[model samples]
Target: MSLRVGVIGGGQLARMMVPAAVNLGIDLRVLAEAEGSPAQLAATAVGDYRDLATVLEFAKTVDVITFDHEHVPEEILRELVSAGHSVHPGPDALRFAQDKLAMRRRLSELGVPVPDWAEVRSEDELAAFLEDHDGHAVLKTARGGYDGKGVRLIRDVGESTDWFRILDEDGRGGSLLVEELVDFRRELAQLVARRPSGETRLWPVVETVQRHGVCSEVFAPAPGTTSRLVDLAASIAVTIAESLDVTGVLAVELFETTDDRLLVNELAMRPHNSGHWSIEGSVTSQFEQHLRAVLDLPLGDTATRAPWTVMVNVLGGPSAGDLTDAYPKALADQPNVKVHNYGKEPRPGRKIGHVTATGDELDEAAFEARSVAALLGSDISIAP
Candidate 1:
């Protein structure tokens, strides 16, 4: 009998996992949030993941459950477990990703290097943290924030007037997280997968380029990363997976500080955007690896197929139109490029899809990845 896997939340991530599920002969199913979500191609159920009854009904069918996004309420997840269901990266591990405050506290307790941070509930608490950090800080809501939302900069008490407004009205204390702005050299991501039996494997540490807090491109085996740094990243990822008892993939997003040190930035307990490159770049894609881990199957090799691989996101621009228009040019201009469009309509600043290229040299791979991505997003054109 084939293993049955059910994913909660139908987004691009779940959509991307379909091919992997097919290849492995696993039954893949999705619970979509709407009638025509991106993952509708694989969805068998459509409803709010937060609705306990809906989730319970869906969970009853699959042998194991995973996630596309992490917003499923903790109460619902806990209920699933108590009812004899298997949820990889189970509630305890997932809680860390669901709540920033809980994550920071646990990482600190584990002695993991992280930015100076504090949980602030009121304006005065934020004020004190900012004062200690030279009147500069990044404030974040403890939950329901991603892709640069739910985050704000506070340079002074006056700058935090809106949050202070919330505090004054609702007495929101201990609901916000404030941290000293990191002075990092660049962003890095370490992708690791763990099976329920305790075996784990890692993908090469990659350098990620972000524009206004959104990931723009990724370069595998980050150029100029020393061996020591790579080892450190590996250790950190492995330690966190073990500490949290995380099953399935865990992406440890980090900051390589200007002074040559590493600090834990964030964590994702499922297949993440950072590992998207592995689809065309490695022997085993993160999507397939995630399925294996959750089912306690042995992992596949993570070795890169090429010396270098570059992945670029196909972000939407002002011109929201059918992306197929870009396909002819993208295919003709860069035949070697691999493009995966998420069946999402174009909208400004939205992640519609991504393109990747692999070659012997990093520069050429990066150039083609970017050029193809631009062509697909209407950022660049191939004129006759």
Candidate 2:
């Protein structure tokens, strides 16, 4: 019998893993919150992830458990471990991904290159942080924030009073994470995977383009990356995975500073968007690698299959309905391009899927991916 892997949360991440699990002879089961969630096609149970009893019952059926998102409460994860379930990137390491304050504190302790940050629940505390830095800063909710939801930029701390009020109204000071706004030259992502038996590997550092806090595109081996920068990025990811005892995949999102340095921006201990190019670009895709890592299987090579690979997200547009209608046109236009639709309803600005392309030249790879992604979403022409 194949090892059964149970995934918590039913976003596109879990949906994408189905095929990879099937190929590896792993039985993938999903616990989704909704009947029509992206991973519903592979769902074995549908219930609230926050409910302890619901998750525990599902955990009993699977040999191992992993996450599609980091929103699972720490208590639920810890309870699973207490009950003897195998959870990759277990509660101890997952806490850093779940809470920005905890992440910042822990990375700081480890001397990890992270932007100077602090925890603040009130405007006065935020003002103090702003005063320490220039007059501007980025404020984020320490918990329940992603894809721009619960993030903000403020020159004056007073601008955040309403959030403070809401937090106070919630019966106590709510979680708030504040950080100095770095004058970053660009954003970079480094992906690494580790197993419980201590095997680890790193993927090439990649450049990430963000639109309104969401990832828009990814370029493998980040164009113009110096050997020094590449080494530094890889080392940081490796160190974090080892130090945190993180199992499965760990994505280190960093800021390439204007002053020529790296400051960690965030961490995601799972298959990440920046590594999406691996599906068609690398010797081993992250989904397959994640399964291997969690199962204590020998790790695969992280080498790129092509000289260059580009991935562009397909955003839902005003004209978007069902993307199936556009698939024929996109595929016919660029058969060399690889398109992955998340099987989600089209809502404006939503990330429904992505398109990837690989080639000998960076320009050609980027052009193919972008053009197909544009066709799949809005008709915005991307100039090479």
Alpha-carbon RMSD of each model: 2.5, 1.5
Worst 10 residues of 1 by lDDT: 375-384
Tell me the tens digit of each residue's lDDT in model 1 across 1-384.
889999999999999989999999999999999988888988999998989999999999899999999999999999999999999979999999999999999999999899999987677888889889988999987787888887887797677677667756775443688989999999999999999999999999999887767788888978898999999999999999999999999999999999999999889999988899999999999999999999999999999999998988887832746888778888899899998888888887789888889999998888888888877773331111
Tens digit of per-residue lDDT, candidate 2, span 204-279:
9999988878888899989999999999998999889999999999999999999999999999999999999999
Task: Go through the candidates in order and give each one's C-alpha lDDT.
Answer: 0.89, 0.90
Candidate 2 contains a number of clashing pairs equal to: 0
Q: Each model's TM-score?
A: 0.96, 0.97
Model 2 ranges with Cα > 4 A deviation? 317-320, 379-384
What is the C-alpha local distance difference test score of candidate 1?
Answer: 0.89
**Best candidate according to TM-score:** 2
